[model samples]
Target: MVQSGNQNKRETDGGTSLESYTVRDPERFALNLARALEEAGKAAAAWSRPREAGEKPDTMAEPLADMVKTFSKLTEYWMSDPARALEAQTRLFSSYMGIWANSIRRMSGEPAEGEPVEPEAGDKRFQDPDWATHAFFDFLKQAYLVTSRWASDLVENAEGLDEQSRHKARFYVRQVSEALSPTNFIMTNPQLLRETFESDGENLVRGMRMLAEDIAAGKGELRLRQSDYSKFELGRNLATTPGKVVARSDLAEIIQYAPASQTVLRRPLLIVPPWINKFYVLDLNPERSFIRWAVEQGHTVFVVSWVNPDERHGNKGWDEYFREGIEFGLDTIAERTGERQVNVLGYCVGGTLLAASLALMAQETDDRIASATLLTTQVDFTHAGDLKVFADEEQVEAIDRAMKEKGYLEGSRMATAFNMLRARDLIWPYVVNNYLRGRDPLPFDLLYWNADSTRMAAANHSYYLRNCYLENNLAKGRATLCGKRLSLAEVKVPVYNLATIEDHIAPAKSVFTGSRLFGGPVEFVLAGSGHIAGVVNPPGLNKYQHWIGGALGESLEGWLETAQAAAGSWWPHWQAWIEKLDDTRVPARKLDRRKKMLGEAPGEYVRARV
Candidate 1:
């Protein structure tokens, strides 16, 4: 009964036409509508089911609601005029088919009409010659890329969802599309396929064995290939710098490195590393060791080695880290070095604690802190980066509940979260290499230290999440520590702040913003690479570069625009700055035998495993 002219015209126009396929039969359209609704209902029921403990609650509810509204509108259009509904369905199919056809044409040596589909700059999987030479594989790669773009466009344009919800939708969609890439699959991946055939299908058998081994290891997910944990021992190869633990507490130990210079700065240096990981990250390998480098620069260095906390230490709070950790270390350094004032440095979360400790010290008119250096630390949570996605009230509460059950946050859990942020680089490579290729993981010093994680006390972690992240209390000067209200503005010591350009954990912008919060003259430096690499960068390698601004500006953009790029490491620059502040040079002093010595350089606490 309906006119077939539009349908024929659309078909004749090829896949480029946006006209819907005309449904000549009304009953058929009604039946399709019923089937779609039935499937949606089933999906809704499944989504509503109770989730397992520690599982992240679904964030797709709003997006799913928007989808349901779209479907309902389409259903109404079908009921009113089945022909229009058919046209809508046809238009959607044609759009997708057109995309595939264009990809095919490009793969077949036909020039593409618009800009060519290019892989993301960082994605190098398709850079191989086979991907370009082989038409079939090239088509697969192009098709997947085009599909991902189309999906992203749809999510970006979707209506009825809030900004945050839309962001969540886009992120999840990207993750899903990336996971489904042809390069990830054995059959579609040219390299993997060739390797499989060359190995006579032995790779598949080995992959199966590798997967079973991972499961048996009780990690429940494949992370890395079987690593020889014994090869990279602490205090031997890594964290091998010559030092001695002079003081010990339940929370931390102060290690005083033997000076490498004839004359050292009269004021000693105390390093406070994040309790989230072992302290030896600063002292890892003599060549790349920051502590050793400082000692060589004629600055007596002392590091706080935090205890790998357990259920018994679950009740420890931020106060303990300040009173028994930073303050205690400062006291020990002053006692051993006979220096009334000591230069202080803090890394990541340790910087946050140091900032609070300085504020507390200022409140009581304590003048022990001569200067402070903050490395890749964020006191302001306003722009804390992608990690903010997990800082929502619901997510934080869920984390708290999980931590309560275990009495502490498991290191493996935190590692997994950090890995997810860079899954393409950190996670999936291991998946393909360890499982698909069935190869053992190569031993790397950095990866070995990264694998050695530490648990966080529940009370301390919860307070940090609530006050620092969720509430933005620290930046607002509302954060309370050590039974005193602390303010960064009150701590008026000279401050040197370092931020990494590619750091995801503590974004450079966030760090820069926090640097401005200090009441004193602040020197903010932007380094290349990520969090760890930026801090551990040495002079000789001349690998990544850094940027230094002449003057601290009000905005990060303005500062970056005025900054100048420098070759080599930022270590020398930092050393020069600290030396300028410290004019008192005295002969290097030996450790007093009267002081109680805890143990050797990489203390017993550093050896504790999660």
Candidate 2:
């Protein structure tokens, strides 16, 4: 069990125990406030810098910087109560000066050099008396509402506290109450606040100063906005993995990775990657890459790198994706590897396509697939969580309208929606650190990977939303792919279902339910971490923990009740499972090149860039 911060503190005779509460470190809070204030100063200096000295400053920065400066000065006043209120008076002076200066600029409609300035519709400082009154009244309304709620809750909760605890609580509550008066909130939030105040008070200023120093020293440089392309390189093992132009009706290109000197195994492994992102996610880096590990374990790996969609592919639907994506790729992998049966691994949306292909293959009696592995994929969308929030008719209509204007769904827009689902962690935290703190966010490899996005054909996305997410037809066995009824129950091959316990996107229960949708022998494994981290989990790391239970027949809840602790990564466990199904103990056999002439490996379709 994870320990609470005050775990060591014992309970007292009073109703409130010290162990039950955790106090914020005053010193740390003060230090953080100081850092934030420093940052505010640097931001102010940056705003004041001449256009030639600094790249043209953002028009938004000047007002925000001006408010931040006022907030800092106010904080300086608070540092020593009754210090003649000298800094407080100066802060008031700066705030009014900023307001009047902005007013003059608005009246003139131009800068000193006759340069035209952008009009501010939301600017609070207007010469019109009515405008200022309305803004101030609205600000006071929100502030009073918040202040009343906070005060009431504190009073109600404090009634049960002991003398000592109650006194501390009262002090904190009073401090908060005084801080919320229309004057304080504005002082704290500054630009948005009714008055000039720090967003995080002193901490924001101090952090900003440190960040400014780092930037000056070429360490933590801030980027106000994000870029479309990422700097990360896609790692490669095959020399012929680069894309080349291909003609219509050409055989799909295949990239194979595995160890040398092994006979063609009976079960070749095929990987289906989501077109929403690049195929490199499976082969991210040598250390954590699933493809690299699979090849090293002596399995012939074949991955399909999808063509990034464009206006020309707008008419392409799920039917086309199945034909060119799975069916064609399967045929190519089989013919090249000389294998009668193969193992397939599907990820996210790719898993949905794979399920459809498997149904089609089964209907045709293809006998090429020996087993199938799905990673955090859903066959049932009934309990899909937040993704369900976006599946309504109105939402679908809105999507259709937007897609009609643009042939393909913009990749960045889709990324934005996904990121919004976890705004606090995914968006705001980074915004505060990078923009407000003046520091560059830590470079996370997974986030870098997520940054790499690709467009989806309009038809493909529409069909997926209607059939898979909204209708929930796939799990119900009412879905049809390529005009053929596709049933999950029919694609009954040895299956491996892996889900992360803490996965927000695809919960373990949802993944577990997907197993019941199939009539195959299933092994459901639960891993640690979220969707991405759980998959890319590498071995040999200390403090890494995961729980494992019995295969499909066992209840997941029952297993969790008696689950055993396992050391190291679950990769070895997966490797063992794959080995048991291997009829041939030998390595993979090399395939003849240029059998069908898919132009070249990778293909131009996969290389299309924004």
Candidate 3:
């Protein structure tokens, strides 16, 4: 062996020289290791720290306890029947035998089983070549997939379990299986193992350092950084569409975007985004910004920027948001543009609020909103997807009690729950990148927006969980707002409903079902992707397809069977629909110079960090 003066330049196995690894400084590595240890200690201490006087105790424990109890019932069903338990055990054991047989055949250089157990298509976790080529990794991958499948089937066929209980079981089972994946560990994952060898344990040091920092950033909870957050700032790289805050209230701020065209639609467009997150998602950037796109399309766009609620907003329920937020926007538009009949769009929870308020207003004979566009919104919560697992009576009650302590639920809690919805993509990838691989994530605008969460007011959140999720009062026409019982049947405005095919939060089925609740002519358009991507899809990018001209039948499957798939973004179709309703062009209105400006485009309400 010829040893060079530069020790890192030495050849690896088989005399093939691999490139020198990045972490060659032992002193630096040692220092980082010490720091990482210190941070980890701090993380543990933070977790153990007692709550101050009057501080809210984490409400998650009761829910977790309930989950365990539910699981026990499921277990009892299987355990009660020896034959059933044996059958389940045999199925898993049989799969293991097949995997073992395949391994033996591969070692003997014979053909392996043609139909071997494999990860489902597009399963990114087992994408590495070694997972396919190497015996050890292949076995591990197959074993994991098999076990996860077995557990899933057990829950699926579990007798006498209610839908909610079944839903919770499926969600938690997936979460547990995802958490226990072989790829997450350094020893099991070929890529991480190779990295470990090349770096000489330097990666571990750096990963631990990041681990400590993330825990601290989350204030004892692990706030997984999906992207390099330092690269972003509000109004700098993001939310840059030129505009001004024309209206402000306790609940929300109204931003009137600068008109991109000389002439704009006579009817102004009011966007009400979900208060759970900031409004900037619709206006993320120039390319993906719906506000900028709509402005360029000759429409005056006004968006409601909900204030990140605190204890002061604790009592602000659905009624208050309707009056102060949506009603306020309509009033502002009328005063500024003298256009009372405005086209309105609502996204997610904001959409639900818009529908409810429209019902209330229709009852009062208020014809302020002319047409409505709902984006991935749900008026019904019967099939509200995995999020329902968190909205049961016990959990909601617990959340309400905990929220009352501080008058609001913590923003991080909401962020965590949403992440849990797509844990494999949102949670584990960040874990592997930040903690296991010792690497910071790339700078992404959407992820940056996702991390920026908003607290829920106690009253508003309580009403939402109980009415929409628990009781499903909104869909049943029993949801009372102001002095009247709200019903979607009373609103006669033309509605444009957009649902994404792959939305986890608001399932396409759920969205389709909610469309039937509207009394007016509802044009249900199905977009190609998930919640955010489906809506923010720009026409220039031409990424996904949209399904139109399908009859809204009783079942989502029946509609999909007959739905016509059209290429490109659904924006153009929506624009055409709006034009059909009313396309009278008027000279674009400018912000009033005589009136006071609350702030700039993105507004101070959105800039609220906490």
Candidate 4:
């Protein structure tokens, strides 16, 4: 028990008792303290050796510098008028005073006055009982929340700032706020502090050792461990949908899965998975594998397993990828299966490339593709979420300069960018769990695939950023592809567009708007979760939900007003759509018939780690 008055007294730290801060095991702590120092030395060695060996990247982005400049704009707006600056200061100071008063009342066994500050529902940061029940922690939590929220609002409501500046300000604020959270520090975090006391600081010693190991693993960079990577291997356990590598190109390998059904659909399906990551996301395990499920559904599935690009593919642009990747897949499919026209499915960047390819095909009167399905793909990047913040001209130019020297962008750069999109969930938790808690992460297949990143070819990534993001060219029917103007409006293939309702990479509104670009009948469907879970959800799992409606309206909100909701995965609904288009059947095509078997499925390309 502690008294509220005289906070500076030795017996109390504000309202928390000084006596309560005692280590339960003093002898254990005394022994572990030396070990903790030794571990700290190891962590320092791990950091310095990479720089000494010149292994540290010279072109690593200076985000902090950019953040400083972005925040300065917000600083200017608030400081322009003395009265405005004073008002802002007053607002913050008032919130602090309220928190102090509330803390005193709480110590005296009284209710808080109207709850001046509280964490929003679903925010897991302040979930500890001490954060609410204890006076000091509760005050600290409320004070931090109020100040951070106020800071964010200042940026959001700032006038005389351009859209881009405003956006950068908001993003930077969030990054700063999250980084500065009290929970991140052992001193401020009750749980971490308690753990340290109980473990006699041995937790920190082990965490430091792991931190050193992770730094060493990343080769001078921090590769935050989200899962036990040792628990997974492609083709062995993860990408285990039995398949053969029927074809290989400079950019991709074509894998034809074994048909489970004796008779399969005549129209063979080719999946173009994003080259930014491995193809195993769709085929993580037998139960969650869409590839395995599709084979069970009597479809001859062939997937494009893209190469982990390097210096050799530096100059490979969008056209080359269109030619060497998709065209190569089409050629091999025709030769191996004797099917000219095929059904196609593309995920993420693969979907964007496929849509553009179909558009290019439309122009050349090439009708090889019968129908198309795009999974969480964006043709228009207007509402593409936080990713657009990094695609600005300045940042894109910096990426260009870096890529020019290195030949290709490092896989970790893209991985970091994607992680930033959901940092509260993806980044900090791992930081706390892996480093603070001194524990190996539990085995999770999706996270394992997420960590297994792939490099981006220079020219291809640049063109994509400029055309799709910097300019809304593809949606506007002005994007040039293969020495010809590309128009999504010209693409007449029946399209099935899937968008995750909670997608940060590709917002449903953006997908719904882009649907209007297609010349053919576009069936816009909304899945239940975010990008990965939304698309990879298998029907047999009996999880999540989906929405399919009569027709899309001018706006997403208008369409959702009338859209019908159905429980479970969207895969069966998509398969049903495929049947409605063309359901011809033929004997399952043997894999080793036409093209020589180059390798096994989940090819050697995916095995290349950066």
The most accurate candidate by lDDT is 3
Over 412-510, each residue of candidate 4 has an lDDT whose tens digit, in order, gives 899998998888889988888778878789999999999999999999999999999999788888888899998888888999999999998888888
User: lDDT rank, highest first?
Assistant: 3, 4, 1, 2
Higher-lDDT candidate of 2 and 4: 4
Consecutive 10-residue window with the lowest summed lDDT within model 3: 12-21
Number of the predicted model whose TM-score against the real structure is largest: 4
Q: Point out the higher-scoring one by TM-score: 1 or 4.
A: 4
Reference-based lDDT, residue 18, model 4: 48
TM-score per model over all chains: 0.83, 0.62, 0.94, 0.95
Q: Which stretches of candidate 3 lie over 4 Å from their true place?
A: 1-39, 50-56
Displacement of residue 392 (Cα, Å) in model 3 is 1.0
Name the weakest run of 10 consecutive residues (lDDT summed) in model 4.
Answer: 1-10
Residue 518 Cα positional deviation in candidate 2, in Å, after optimal superposition: 0.5
Candidates in order have lDDT scores of: 0.77, 0.60, 0.88, 0.87
Q: Decide which is better by TM-score, 1 or 2.
A: 1
Q: Given candidate 3, what's the lDDT at residue 101? A: 92
lDDT of 2 by residue, 260-314 (tens): 4355456778888777877766665656677766766667777777777778788
Taking every candidate in turn, the Cα RMSD to the unseen true structure, in Å, is: 10.9, 18.3, 3.5, 3.1
* Model 1, residue 9: C-alpha shift (Å): 45
Enumerate residue pairs that collide in model 1.
20-87
